[model samples]
Target: MSSSTVKTIQDTLKAWKSLVFPTFKVNDLLYFFLKAGLAVSTFALVSLFFYLSLSHPSFNSSSGYDYKTFKHLVQQRTIADASAGAEPTNVSHILFGIGGSAQTWNTRRHYTELWWKPNVTRGYVWLESEPPEKENWPETSLPYKVSANTSSFKYTCWYGSRSAIRIARIVKESFELGLDNVRWFVMGDDDTVFFTDNLVTVLAKYDHNQMYYIGGNSESVEQNVIHSYTMAYGGGGFAISYPLAAELVKILDGCIDRYSHFYGSDQRIQGCISEIGVQVTEEPGFHQVDIRGSPYGLLAGHPVAPLVSLHHLDYVEPIFPNMTREDSVKKLVITYKTDPGRILQQSYCYDLRRNWSVSVSWGYSVQLYPSLMTAKKLETAFRTFQTWRTWSNDPFTFNTRPMSENPCERPLVFFLDRVESVDGGETRGSYVRYVDVSQKECDREEYVPALAVQYVNVSASHFLSDLWKKAPRRQCCEVINGGDGVDSAVYVKIRSCQASESLTPP
Candidate 1:
């Protein structure tokens, strides 16, 4: 090569190195600034997200408060003071009317089955504006004034049937009359008979500070049904607190239009109250006594017995209808020895058949005993053995027994056999050896014999009664009596037996 060409190439190489090396330093500075800016931006975004999440309105520190404190706050907001014209004693009894023939209304009166009347101060009836002209209308006493409103009929198809509308009208009228002070609002159909005297006393024992809506019975709603909420059976003798009623009325008045297509008044009320966040206490004794095949003859240890108001009105001939109001009331008046041995033998075995893995054998033995049997069985036995015992011995006595039979003069006896101990210690055996019999037995005397029994626990009896009252017919077998050492348990099992034999009316 030539010397001049070599010098030109070296000059070009020197110029290119100076420009490229200087630009490389500038690119490094730019990359450092870009990475630092991204890190700072990420930190700021995360901090903002956490702050917003913690400070949101729905997220409150109050959620950590104890249940008692939260409940107190709710009570203060919902319930009014008894002295502030919100006293439960202000009104008594919520009268319900079932829409049907006049004969149905007459049947209710003849039965004298409105259980809430004695507990409440007044009663009201919901009826069609015009009375049905029927042959069976009673000639004597009619307790309630009939109202004639058909606005309820418009939603009949949606609510339930015509009978449900009748109950709704009665409820609406009771509310309109400012009967919220009435502690127990007994609502049900005409066919029902509420006869328990202990209902008011039982309700009085619960803390009245909180607002509650008690239902007589509940029914499941079909999944495919269209409405604001699924329907429940508020028709059969349901009671609600005045505060709950007020809240329900507000919701009803507001949402009635949107749910105009919904027909049943009970359903509408249930939906409205539910939306307002009122929970339902389904007590036993509240019943829907439809005359499908036979009538429920006796009333013994029925849960709703204390708060019952009958519903679903129907009538039948004296002979054809084996069970009469008099017969039921008579059973309530009698006191018979409930044989524990028999109760165990006849009592339906619920846990034994279903929950054998979890339950102890003793629970099974107690649940099926004569005294702890199904409601129907107890009722029938009481009715059949009415002559065997005296009314004075009954806890809730109102009458005496016939002179021909031994007046259940024997003191209540309880037999106890020592079973396993809690810590596997020595077993204990005891029995109520003797109890003095007396005519004036309604007081301490009545319960003394039963109380004397070493094996029988009053609390256990009450618990069993409560379970029998709340459970459905077939479901009664699951109830257990365990106070000695075993924990109370329930089991679901299928029963192959048909309904028990009907009780004979005296």
Candidate 2:
């Protein structure tokens, strides 16, 4: 080989040896591994953080997330956790604000006292001014608080009373108190009689941590239309969830002036809530009672829900005949205490042997019809009352069946006389025949058999409050014993409907 070629090959071999067999000290190797370990750990940590930010609802808002969206997500998570883990809502969690006037509070206080349990129910009666004899305030009545002056706010509703402005601020004032553990702010007129057990049952169905505006609109379409169908009639009472009330109080006073053209306090509240993008969650149990006549038909065929509140009591006739309004209310309240879950719960069944159709309002009354009636017709309320404004027969919020003028066609009516708890959480409600001496008696032979039946004994198992959480269905009824009209009374049993059973007539 040439001498130049040999020298080039020798240099290449030396370079390859240096590249393939490079040497390193022990400390250098240790330093290299430490750097590699730190890089791996950093990569793992970054991956873990990203995973948590994307997957976890309770993530930190500062970690590159839209703050409002993050806040909403966190609130949703918190509400879900609260609804699942928190204690059940009770009367102690509800703060009531009853709008009253010193001039009329004395007479109206009776209605409030009926349901208000001193020290048990938390709330105040917000008055226009200090009531007469404030130092002598009855222990049974709700503690009174004079509402903050609302005279500065404009109320342009020509037909509506200015008292609405003061009443609208009661909610804001109630929230400002900052009471602890209050889940609901209930607003009502002093005359509204709340069935608190039923009220709690209804409220328990919802999560108070979330925004909720729960109530019923006026029974009269005209009333609803004049105000707003979306508004919860304040007289009937409406519940504002704590979260919603917090938001409402912030903007309510400003909203009152903005919605000055609104007719009622409820409308103004609804107007404010609407700006917040929440809607009224109408619960049929809240009764505005915007009717001019008898509430019998309405009560007897109550919608299949708990009776939350009843308003306009003084405007209508006593629920029972031949009784003072106070006494009538007392009677109903007594029955309500016996079976709050079952009060006004309607159930009807047929005695095929005697061709009798019996409709029982568990804690109220019963009707015995000699002829067969469809379940739809039986469930539909009788038009014994008229609209509040026009005092007309038509245009009610619910469907009503007209009362038959013919005595023979009408069913024999009965009213609840007594209710008692029996063995194993069962309730026996006895209803006595109600005879209207002024009206003509049904002389038909078929009706005579029903007339002989003077008493209806209805037995029902205690209705569990949790049943409200389920899809609503009316309880089923069966005639226990009405043997060939020989017995002076009929017995009936009301129970949860079997899966296969239905209210279809034979």
Number of the top candidate by TM-score? 2
TM-score of each: 0.42, 0.84
Q: Give model 1's clash tally.
A: 22
lDDT of candidate 1 over 1-506, digit per residue (tens):
69797667556655654686555444354455578899999999888555533422112243353545434433433334442434333234333333334445554554444333444445644565445643444434334556545453444254345544445555545544433334444555544444433344334434444566665433112211332223335445566654565455444544544444665566666766778777667555454432222221222223323424444334321211224545533332221112111112122332232222111112111212212223343332222112111222222211222222242332222222222222322122122222225433324333332333233211122113333334233222232342233332222221223557322221
lDDT of 2 by residue, 248-365 (tens): 8767888999989987888899999999999999999999999999999999989999999999999999999899999999899988998898899998888889888889988889
* lDDT by candidate, in order shown: 0.38, 0.87
Give the Cα error of residue 451 in candidate 1, in Å.
29
Evaluated against the true structure, the overall lDDT of model 1 is: 0.38
Superposition error at 223 for model 2 (Å): 0.7
Q: Pairing residues by index, what is the TM-score of model 1?
A: 0.42
